[model samples]
Target: MTARDLGLPSRVPAPGLPERVTIWEVGPRDGLQNEDAVVPVEVKLEFLDRLADAGLTTVEATSFVHPKWVPQLADAEELLAGLTPRDGVRYPVLVPNERGLDRALAAGVRHIAIFASATETFANRNLNRTLDSQMAMFEPVVSRAVAEGLDVRGYVSMCWGDPWEGAVEPGAVVSVGRRLLDMGCSQLSLGDTIGVATAGHVAALVNAFTDAGTPVSALAVHFHDTYGQALANTVEALRHGVTTVDSSAGGLGGCPYAESATGNLATEDLVWCLDGLGVDTGVDLDKLADTSAWMATKLGRPSPSRVVRALRG
Candidate 1:
């Protein structure tokens, strides 16, 4: 059935309209990046293919970080080289620096994502550098990628709270977001790395960025389910005109630096929420649940996505 058939709302009636929420599935990269058991290259490729087949247009394909840091994705080059390119899907890789950008270029990556943090402590812990240093490094990488005809996406982590520092200021998020946008990033994804944000916080941040002259259309929200608020926060973001969300299949991720936080909002769960709200996601809920379940079996762990478990019954 189409979204209209599902009795979901197509558009909000306010002066601002959140046309459609774009779901960028990150199961292949953020979901599996920290798994203790290394997933095989073929398996990763198959998982990505399944996501594409399920109608995901944007997928975070992989990361080009150091193999020593994340050995699970040590086969980044081989995986990128072997992916069967789909006609309309955009597969973007995460590049932490110029070295990663060079590798992505050599491997024919057409889109790349860079990450920065809002807090100095979280920035140092996650990226091993101060916020300014991280921005300085990514500025040229973003420019070079854009010059080469690649779409650049920038992720600003710890928009809500930081593990080392508490209560990240909204202005801090805006500062990094503006720099990323000015540096030639096509989109800026604000991430609640530790998942401490509430719906109120979500609305506040989205408005803060918009009021600062960054278009709401250029901003996306990424939330962890640590506090069970990702979905609620996503709804708040949509109401405020932020239309893009970053999610992982099976809810399969957690911050390496943030203790006890779970994955981003599950893609299946997000699809279900949007479907119920009459929002068009263009994703098949049952197929996504099946894929997440199959991956859970392969990993010998319970699928973290709530919709997946509920649908399996």
Candidate 2:
């Protein structure tokens, strides 16, 4: 029987959730970048098209990082060139530095995201810059992107815990996030990179940001599913008035630098929760699951998403 026939996830509106949540879909870029085999440029373009069709308004398209580091997404230029931009959908690309910003400008990208590490050990290992020096790297990129009239979003990774530096402080996350907002970024996405965050920690961290003067409107949560807390943590964030959430289709992503990191909370999974809560995200769940299933076939494996397996079975 179909999910519809099964009457799965009965709608019962949650009391404190946002009336409508903005889902920041990161499948094409963050999802495919970690794959062992390179996905063809044509396939990438079609993937974007399918995501937009599935009603993902802000689909992260690709990264402009150096190919030497992330070879899988080396076809960023080709993919952008072939992309058929949708009328209402936004395609945001990841820009790593000034050079990447230059490439983004050349490709006519209107929105971009710059990543930062929340802890010192992660900063040194992932960014090759000390915790404080990393801002120097992102400052110019954010400044230039803002000057060009492009929207910039900042990502603070390792928000909850780090492999080398266990138990990240909420104040430290707020410190990094506030600086990014100070740097002209329109929004900041706090990442649970290793997926160690629980609901209580999530509440405390969101409270810290608001307590320190950052509004919930300017914050987004990106939770990894490594420890199975992604969905529960997402609910906690929603309860605290966080409207923007970052999720990947089919749970297809991981951090290359952090071996403990796992795939993002599945976009299908997020949609199911939101759908049941009567929170509007504008994503069609069945279509999204179908897209993830098709993507899984391309990778020669079953999808890791429980919702996808349940619905597609």
Candidate 3:
């Protein structure tokens, strides 16, 4: 039987959910970066094409980080060069520093993302700097990108909980988020890097950001499904006025730096929830599920997305 046959509600019973939500698909970069085997550039390109065809408007194409760090996505330049840019589709690449920005700029990228951690331990481990220093490092990159008319997104990792530090205070996330916004990022994506957040935790963090004078509209949520709370947390964020969400196709991401973190909230799963709520995401659920299932073949594993698995069954 199909999902529709299951008699799911066409719209959510709860009020206050946005009529439309923007989903930023991060499978191409974050999803593939931690893979044990190298995915050929051609396969990566095809995966991107399928994702775009599945109706994702904002697809993070690749990261311009050092090849040594993320060898799976070493072909960022080639991937960007080979893409057939679609009208109304935005492709953003991750840029670690001015050097990565230079590479992205050279590759003709128009949108880039810079990431910082809310906790000191994650900051030191991931960026090899303190929280303050990491913010300082991204300042120049954000400034240069804005000056060049490139869309910039800032990611604050470990927004809810940290592996070493445990139970992160929302205030610390707010401070880093405010700095990133002040640095000229068009949007800030709050990440539950270890997927330890519950719905209540999600609500508190969103409220904290708004209480600190940061517009909820400028914020996005990026959650991992480790504790099985990603969808619940996403619903809480949406109810709290956050309209942008970051997800991966086939649930294909895990933070390499934070080894305990699991796969990201799947694009298919998110789309299914939104579709049932009568929320518009401009994404075709069946197409996305099929695309992910196809990618599973390339990755030599079954897709982790429940929606994809159900559709395939």
Clashes of each: 2, 0, 0
Winner on lDDT (1 vs 3): 3
Q: State each model's C-alpha RMSD to the native.
A: 3.2, 1.0, 1.5
Better of 1 and 2 by TM-score: 2
Q: What is the C-alpha lDDT of each candidate?
A: 0.87, 0.94, 0.92
Ranked by TM-score, the better of candidates 1 and 3 is 3
* Model 3's TM-score against the true structure: 0.97
Model 2, residue 3: distance off in Å is: 3.9
Runs with alpha carbons beyond 4 Å of true place in candidate 3: 2-13
- Candidates in order, TM-scores: namely 0.94, 0.98, 0.97
Tens-place lDDT digits, model 2, residues 87-161: 999999999999999999999999999999999998998889997899999999999999999999999999999
Winner on lDDT (2 vs 3): 2
| Cα misplacement distance, residue 10 of candidate 1 (Å) | 14
RMSD of candidate 1 to the truth, in angstroms, is 3.2
Tell me how far the alpha carbon of residue 139 in candidate 2 is from the true structure, in angstroms, after superposition.
0.6
